[model samples]
Target: MKFLDQAKVYIKAGNGGPGCVSFRREKYIEFGGPDGGDGGKGGDVYAEAVEGLNTLIDYRYQQHIKAKAGVHGMGRDRTGAGGADAVIKVPAGTQIIDAETEEELADLTEIGQRVLLARGGNGGFGNTHFKSSTNQAPRHANPGQTGEERTLILRLKLIADAGLVGLPNAGKSTFLSAVSKARPKIGDYPFTTIHPGLGVVHVDGREFILADIPGLIEGAHEGAGLGDTFLGHIERCRVLLHLVDGTSEEPLEAYNTVRGELEAYENGLAEKPEIIALSKCDSLDEELEDLQAEPIERATGKDVARISAISGKGMIPLLRQIADAIEADKAAERGKDARPEPAWQP
Candidate 1:
């Protein structure tokens, strides 16, 4: 299926049923009073996040969504039936926003998360509600209120534990395919991956999702070479795996170019924990590998691993490092959540 991350839709809630205006007419009773029944409520509109879906492509075809109107009231003091509700099923990690006002409505990060988009109008009062001692007989009934309508925007951001980022032809896709079952398109050209792809990596009996987005080049934040549009897919990742091509003429320059784009794109992505690796190490001998990684290691002041996705060199160690980083991030998140809220100051 084609991946679509953003969509705009118009939705309208159901209208309430009109109240009934009727009086009881009995053969035995001489005086008949107003016996009008109240109208039923209208249906509501809700947006729910469900699993097994990762794209908003379905919303592209259907732009308008509306709920059913409530049944009209009868003349024999019978209440109208309520309208059927309208539920919109969206993928997890979809954020709902008001199109006109540019206000955020809901952010569905987990499966089964639901939020009410629009509330149905209230049912009108019946003639019996207006019956009082001052007014012996009521002849009129209120009309049903109108339903609410609004335009909404849905933006999807994929959730992953680790993100793969590098310059084009840096072997990011090769590493993902070697580590996980995801088989993304592979070629010898730049921008081979036009979109983002996801893979589930299992390391040491532990599983975590990994995302591979389109490669970034220098000035990517300024609309150069894929324009850093796919970077949002990895915003939720806890760690980043930066791959520098060992065969490239200047590996450190390539690494610095991608790093510059990440820092320019903002959203704390630049500060995320990163593990640098020299990819396609099998193509180079020990001397070449050391020569290519020496500059990057010295510039970054960190140890860079030598890996070859085709030959499965250094794959296990890389996966273990990613897993450890993921676990550490999870532990930190748990600690933050477990901390008491400032002890409830008086």
Candidate 2:
């Protein structure tokens, strides 16, 4: 199936059932009394985050979802049956928004998280309620209230600990394959990866998920070079593993190009915790590798990691560095949680 991270859809809740009016009589009875029953409530529509769904392609084709309507009420005080609720399974990390207003509705970050999109309509009153003390016989009934409807937007963000970013053929795929069991397609040409790929890096009894986003180029923010659509996949990443081709004509230029695109696309994306690396180090010698690190590190104001995805050199150290960054981010969040909130002043 094709990967779709964004989708727009319309959802509707079930309508309530109508009330029933009837009269009961016996062979010897002279008069009959009103015996109307109330209708059942309508069904609600909800979206749930479930595992095994990694894409929003299903929502692309089916844009409209509606729940079943409740059954009508019966006579002799027999209430109608309620409508069955509808549940749509969505991928984890899906964010629901109001499509028309662009307002955020819900952020489904964990598995099995559910959000009610539309509420069911209320049931109507029965004719028996209209029978009052003033009138001996009365007949009246109320219609069921309508259900709620809303247009929604569903966006999927990749929830990974570390994200891999680079220009095409920067050995990102190779690095992921070497580190984890994920086998993404690899090629020697540009744009080898058309979609985002995921892998888990396990080192020293510690494991973390790594995502390989498609290569980005200059002018990516202005809809150039595959645009910035895929950038959302890495927005929630705790740390970024920047891969620059070590053998490129100008390693620093390659580094700057990808870095420039990141800053242009998302505000503060460039400021995120990042671990820079000179990929494809097998083609370079020890002297060149040592010399190459200084300028890259000095220019970016960050240390540069060296690795040869094919030869497996520097893989362990690189993985350890990423793990360390992940742990530190977690620690910082914990520290924030430990801090107590200030008391409100009168």
Q: Highest lDDT among the candidates is held by which one?
A: 1
User: Candidate 2: where is the Cα deviation over 4 Å?
Assistant: 343-346
lDDT digits (tens) for residues 171-288 of candidate 1: 9998889989999999999999988999999988999999999999999999998898889898999999999999999898999999999999999999999999999999999999
* lDDT (10s digit) by residue, model 2, range 1-346: 7888889999889888888776665678677677777778889999999999889999888999888777777778777788788887898889999988999989999998998888888777777777777754557666676788899999999889999998888998999999999999988988889889889889999999999888888887888767778888888889999998988878888888998898888656787898999988899998999777778888978888888988988889999999999999999999999999999999
| Residue 269 lDDT (model 1) | 96
Q: Assess each prediction's global lDDT (C-alpha) against the native.
A: 0.90, 0.86
**Model 2 RMSD to the real structure?**
1.6
Clashing pairs in 1: none
Give the Cα error of residue 205 in candidate 1, in Å.
0.9
Clash count for candidate 2 is 0
Question: In candidate 2, what residue range of length 10 has the lowest lDDT sum?
Answer: 135-144
